[model samples]
Target: MSDTSGSQTNITDGQQVQLLERVSVAVVTTLPCCVFLFINVTMLFTLRSKPVFCETSRYVLLYNLLFADTVQMALGHLLYLFAACRLFLTYPVCGLLILLACFTTTIAPLTLLVMSLERYVAVCYPLRHTTIITIRNTGVAIVVIWAFSSLNILTRVLLLLEFPFKDLESLQMKEFCSGVYVLLGPRSKDYDRAFICVLFVSAGVAISFSYFGVIIAARSASTDKASARKALNTLLLHLVQLCLILSSTMFDPLFMALSGILTRIVFVRLYRVLYIFISLFPRCLCSLIYGIRDQTIRPVLMQHLCCGFLKPAVSNSK
Candidate 1:
């Protein structure tokens, strides 16, 4: 209660607020995502059917997403936790944290793009999917995704850290470090804004077109309405998954911008509240959403978590 009102007091710079938000986000993201990753990794081995080309390629994409998600989640949580405890995102460590956040954000979107592409090939080119989505081909694609992400982040980080500002201390830091350029100064962040706008549009178009092409190509003269509807529902579930991914990423960006401005203008700790909500709720719910929407995914998850519950009833009855 007092935290909100006291936000304006004893505030020489933003370092205190930044520390608070970072710590809060650390707790929110770390435990939930770590548990989710451990369960998913186990299921990949134990629950999934044998690796045919389509299945293998799908798992490849999923593994990439899980790896990237957990990496990003851990980075967001741990880096901030350590920084808050040690105040590391300052002086010598500032550049390093910026570099890492850049890379994590980059990998996240690339993995999503790969998942979309994998689904496209499977749905659009079924007969050829077996040949096209080989282990070697998937390995190459995985390498390309990581390579492209690393290069993109490297270039962007270089551009960001090289901002003409002489004193980073003079600039106001926000919950998200990436927003250093966006609201920290009087000038517009044209370079980053343009870069992000282009990436968002490009990703959006590629996702849309790939799915459209798949649906159109898979359209058949002899196909029944029921089968078509089933295919369409499967696509919807993927779309749902993609929506969660997009929302989760964009939420971080939104908080970054809004928090930078609010703390700058009103001196209120609104960002603190918002940061906690965004970090905890979205990541946890997004992971659980996969289990909720897809019947197959839901059962697979339940079998792992609830098999013991089922066993108790059977034993009692017997």
Candidate 2:
């Protein structure tokens, strides 16, 4: 009787392990990549169909945000997939991925900050907005943002290359390349943490001020209630999107901290699931916030999709 009970317990454990493995793969790798591809493709098609959308500063910023999100999702998820498969990655390839990831990571929040400022100007200084946030100016802002992000990422990469790996086997390039591992010593880790915190805090403060200024301006505009309402709703959407993106950034460090407490196998599986969720969830929110929720783009997207479906049906009848 005891032997039979032990056998049943072993079978249950095996089934649970299999279940976790399947879940990890699906959540960490397959779902995020597929969803990001679909949404980004849809966004590209929508923009292509209506080229005028790119002319507006708001749309241009939003489109760039989408592009950044797509790139980040692609790189992060590909790395996760490789890690899951236990595949080896060359240093150059891994460094490139890390560089791109850092670039996108820096871009996302900065773009959100830009968007917030754009809305603030449009609402708070309606008369000056046209002069301030023109196509040329927006393009310049984007270029500056990219340059700033690249500089920061480049500095980090250079610093990472300088870190001594003599004492730490796990910090070796090959091991660090497999996952989102950084081989920073205590001092380096503190610096990295400070840099990230400062960056996020500054952006957060700017975003908060922008939104608050918009609210005050909107409230004072008693002549155009409809426009005020629309502006408020749009600002609300931006706030939600900012929160989602910020939350996604916390997952990696959070998982690393939690791993020390959890069993190894359990930590690995949970980290996989959480990592993909972190990468993909904000992207889905971005699609809804910028694409589907927008007054201009949503109609074009829906029309394109409908036309695509009806084309096959009409051809079949012919």
Best by lDDT: 2
True-structure RMSD for candidate 1: 7.6
Cα TM-score per model: 0.65, 0.81
Model 2: per-residue lDDT, tens digit, 159-232? 77776655655422555353246535565566667867877887788778886776676667442556556666
Output the number of the TM-score-best candidate.
2
> Clashing residue pairs, candidate 1?
none
Worst 10 residues of 1 by lDDT: 309-318
Give the poorly placed runs of model 1, Cα more than 4 Å off: 1-55, 79-88, 160-189, 217-219, 223-231, 237-253, 256-281, 284-286, 291-300, 306-318
Candidate 1, lDDT over the whole model: 0.55
Q: Taking the tens digit of each residue's C-alpha lDDT, what string does model 1 give over 155-258? A: 65555555566755554433334335233333334555665666656666666776676667557654344434544564555555455555655655675567
lDDT (0-100) at residue 266 of candidate 2? 90
